[model samples]
Target chain A: MAILTGVSMQNRRPLTGWGRTNATVAEVIEVPNHEVAAAVKEAGPRGALVRGLGRSYGDAAQNAGGLVLRLLGSAHQAVLDPSLATVTVPAGVNLDELLRVLVPRGFFVPVTPGTRFVTIGGAIASDIHGKNHHVEGSFGNHVRALTLLLADGSTVVIGPQQQPELFWATIGGMGLTGVILDATVGLLPIETSRMSVDTTRIPDLDALFSAMSDGDDDFRYSVAWIDPQAKGRHLGRSVLGRGDHARLDQLGPKELLSPLAYGPKQLASVPPLVPPMGVINHATVAAFNEVWYRKAPLHREGELKGIAGFFHPLDMVSRWNRVYGSSGMVQYQFVVPFGEEEAMRTVIERLSVSGAASFLAVLKRFGAGNDSPLSFPAPGWTLALDVPGSARGLADLLHGLDRLVLDAGGRHYFAKDGRTTAAAIRQGYPRLEEWKAVRDSVDPEHVWQSDLSRRLGLTD
Target chain B: MDNALGEPQTILLLGGTSDIGLAIVREVLSPGARTVVLACRNVEKGELAAAGLRHGGLAVHVVHFNGSDTASHEQVIADVVAQHGDIDLAILAFAQLGDGAVTSKDVQAASEIAHVNFTGTVSATIAVANRMRGQGHGAIVMLSSVAGERVRAANPVYGGTKAGIDGFAQGLGDALAADGVHMMVVRPGFVHSAMTQGLKAAPFSTTPEQVAAVTAKGLRAGRRTVWAPGILRYVFSALRHVPGPVWRRLPLG
Candidate 1:
């Protein structure tokens, strides 16, 4: 096993996810290589867990009083298989790094989350789905095979055909089954790192849903930025954006020179000084929502944009989460199966009327659910919002949403969950017991654990 | 990291279970705070408080920290810094509010109060300042009281301790200003918190939430010293000039 060189070890290091909520302390060891198995074995009674770019947005990445393995320094390289359109790389390699390397080679990750900072391990662990979920299933569907380091110091190669149950469990398993070391992931071949986007401003919930249902099949990726503050007749008004990977012929003469060049730059960064109250109050969010809504073209087609511009606009501003002020923001993401549009609409109405002040509320259509029991998406409507953590009566409001989601036979995404109750989990995931059984079979000792796992009673 | 509105990503609360501390924390939580360290005398109580405040994606951690443990003040500060790097804000809201009768007559009681409210605070402030100075950026908020401005005969012992901490905090604030570390000394007038729940409501009394709001506003405005109700500033200024004989006769004592 290769030892992690230049990796620092710190005792009682405090950790939080991207959402900046539910902070916990752990002994963090930066695993530099496959030696992570040895490090896990050295963890005390609290056990050991792995953490990647820490983008789970909740306690999923945090292990309180336990040993946390940071894989940022883990020594693994991306090996591109151009012929097969697959890349076998270390799970610690983040999407941003992979994209930078792969895009020029006419290849892109099959699926990507909202941001590119997430590590491949985190993406697979959470089984992240992106705008293309309407067309492609999820990140898990693209994996060829993966090497998982299980408890009791053993490693196994698993895929759909090889150890199917454990393989599916590991996807969106929140890292409870084992540590994902490396994986061969199938990539999508693209001619350019640009998107041919179509923009439309829909007036209301009914119209937006109708438009999506009728036209979503025409595009590979589709999403809508809903104005949560919109009320009454204008309720659920959204700016719909649909796009597909741009081809070489679609580029202009200037762009055609280096069509695959990937340059995601930071335009601005939020400083590290939070004011007493955040800048994103009701008034500011309302105004921002209105401006953003108005800024979209009533109907525009064939608008070319960079991958970062279309997929991860927020990435342009590093530490943008600070905009919410010291009170961190809550990302509420729930998906109700198809034919449950009424429940989804009711939740949106509640959020709007409650004055939750979420400027980044989005609605997207999920194509279908995968075998991963805990995977967040299904063939349904998914709405995600960033609510200020300090909002008064937020917990009650979210709990209410959770109840609605559960009743609709929907579920909240564990990767973005912070305050979900155990009862909600039981109601949301009908196959949770099966997933738990598979997990227990692999790690009966419960070596892999996190604050989220403990909170949701996933670990006994 | 501070957001567009200048909200800190991390906060350190010395009196983790204190109502005032929690209120200030909640106020900060609205903007985009990421990590919170609740250091209190009772870890269990801190944990309970943490659970209540845990929402959104905020991460809350509780550690055993007794304000009266002057000998361990440095270690506590070190441990906090070591665990959580570059604490954006460190709130020294821990203090002992002894009974007026017991504090006035009992040497041990008065010593305990003085030790926790003044000596302990002083030691902790020094340790925090040193760490902040090294980090080159941090803020420290000390919870002082109006009683410190003009020590009244009613609770002279408690007032004396507050007075000592008030002066020490101000001096420390001035010293830290040069090091890019801000020190905010909050002079609230009889805050209605768990500590003062049973006591008579003093003039210009405020709630922990009100104090927290004012403290947050003060932090944003970059004010070194702030009075909770704002009116208390003028009231205290006028009362400070009152003749000692006349002050003693006032019913406030």
Candidate 2:
């Protein structure tokens, strides 16, 4: 008599989600397009979990016996208001789709991550940054408004001008603030997809920092490829690169066909599920590191690289995470203020001595701090690494790194972190208590929640 | 957590052979939920879906459950609880449907429908609810429908049965409110399932996938009710407000 609408008595199998972290739920809900608000209300707050593209490096998207709101296909794109240089987009709209339409219109996002595949909501929640954080700041800085569905099923519009407290609290509060349904974001003008390029191989950490300090003002985007294998004086050897939009004059007569059309054929290979204990060993990574470091030109030079090639090299392989196998992997990124740059050195030293191998090691100098309380960037030195999540002793190693990062007055990026302890998270996120106070006032019943919320003890 | 590093999820499907039910199980249970307990009468068909879900990485087992076998219902519940420690989630999704003409011709058909629909639910709920209530918490989703709101001659038998279940779940929800025991009654309009194979798309007809998605959300939110094509909540609200005389004259079934 109880009408079970879609219960497949024949196929009455309970389905789940993509993020492989937790699997405690008995059932899953795939709401119709644009129904996150009503669905949240109907789901009625047993500590719900909101999921984006399932691309988070860790358990931020996982939950146990809790409600998971998968927003990607549930919400679609909204109309753009060109006059205001702004667009009203659903929280589910991925960045790639947004940029494809915006890039040709002479405007672009001020900050974007390595892959434009992330959702706008995920971007703000994570407050992701690109190589240009040295100039533009994190994605939250470009957001103008956020429409949130609170725990009690009430909706509120928060932004810098409206509900400023909730705005700051939710900016990087993860999904703990509420389900982000839509938002208005300011866009930057861009002439083309091409980046007028430059490259320089700095021999040592000192030279690397000095180059960034002196030349960062000259480029719109900047980052350094660090060699973690290098020891002693050459510990942080790197290749520095800086660029801006390519001007029409910079193109040769033959290249003038579409001077700014800079998307190149992205060609990269991702292995099928990594063989148990597969290729990312110290010997393999050491060899790869040697070749990469040697390939950097010894002298400074300017070279033209397509935007996608330069910014999103990882996007080439569609499901590259499989390369790390079923255990998955973590992208460890942390920022220590300039005064505590030594912390970066200590981390590198620890990784080197432990023989922990990482494929991608990047170093960047962050610029001014944004007003969003939990924003990750500051006037500091940031280092990011892609280390295997299942690496033996990874938990203890990461715990040690957290201690050093805290002692250095720094914090880990929640967006990319999966294993941080609640105490360590509190120490890393200085503004968390302030954000929690705001969340407590709005979601007094404490309904809005996610896997990250439970992991960090941000909710009951 | 239902899964370890690479293990699949453990699922308990109450009514094992429902086609739309299985499709939802396939769509959402993919690559996770390793152990699946299919409680059904035909152990063979149950084994088939179990194998299918297993091929997708889930380990499935078949147990016996007859909705009309009220006396055995308690034992079935006890056996499942004994075997699985505490059921992570028990999908209470069993029901009976009959062609309107046959149901009108033979009141026996209506009685059979009620046997599986209302009486069966009450009997099974008594055992399952006790177990869940005693366990301190778990989610129990009963499949309900929009037709349950008002019975019409077109399918009065099926509709009346659903009406009883819908009301029972509401009351059961209130009773279990404090025990951390939850129930989600899904009210989907006409669905394009095997049960309605040749039926044309009604104004609100939806797919099994859509129903599963909404149900998943309802389960996650710990909601008491889930409506597929969610606008049905307001639409039904308006229907309730229509005067009895006008409602009776309406041609729509």
Please tell me which predicted candidate would have the highest DockQ against the true structure: 1
Error of 1 at A291 (Å): 3.8
**Residues A128-204, model 1: lDDT tens digits:** 99999988989999999999999988999999999999999999999999999989999899999889999999999
Q: Score residue B126 of candidate 1 by CA lDDT.
A: 89
Candidate 2 residue-wise lDDT, A1-460, digit = tens: 1122422222111222222333233123555335665556544334565777767776666554445666654223566778888878888788777766766666677787788778888888878889989888888888899898787677888889898998888887777888888888987766566677788888888888889999998898999998888888888888888888776677677657865453444476666756855567778888988898888787654566676777877887776666655455667888899988678889988877776778758999999977777778878999988776557666567768888988999888877766565666677777777888888998887777554565465774
lDDT of each: 0.84, 0.71
Q: Superposing all C-alpha atoms, what RMSD in Å does each candidate have to the true structure?
A: 7.8, 18.3
Q: What overall lDDT, based on C-alpha atoms, would model 2 receive against the true structure?
A: 0.71
Q: For model 1, state the Cα shift of residue A163 in Å.
A: 2.5
lDDT at residue A83 of model 2 (Cα atoms): 84
- How big is the positional error of residue A373 in model 1, measured in Å on the Cα after superposition? 2.2
Separate clash counts for every candidate: 30, 36
TM-score of chain B of 1: 0.96
- How well does chain A score by TM in each candidate? 0.97, 0.91
lDDT of 1 by residue, B52-86 (tens): 98886677999888877778988988887777555
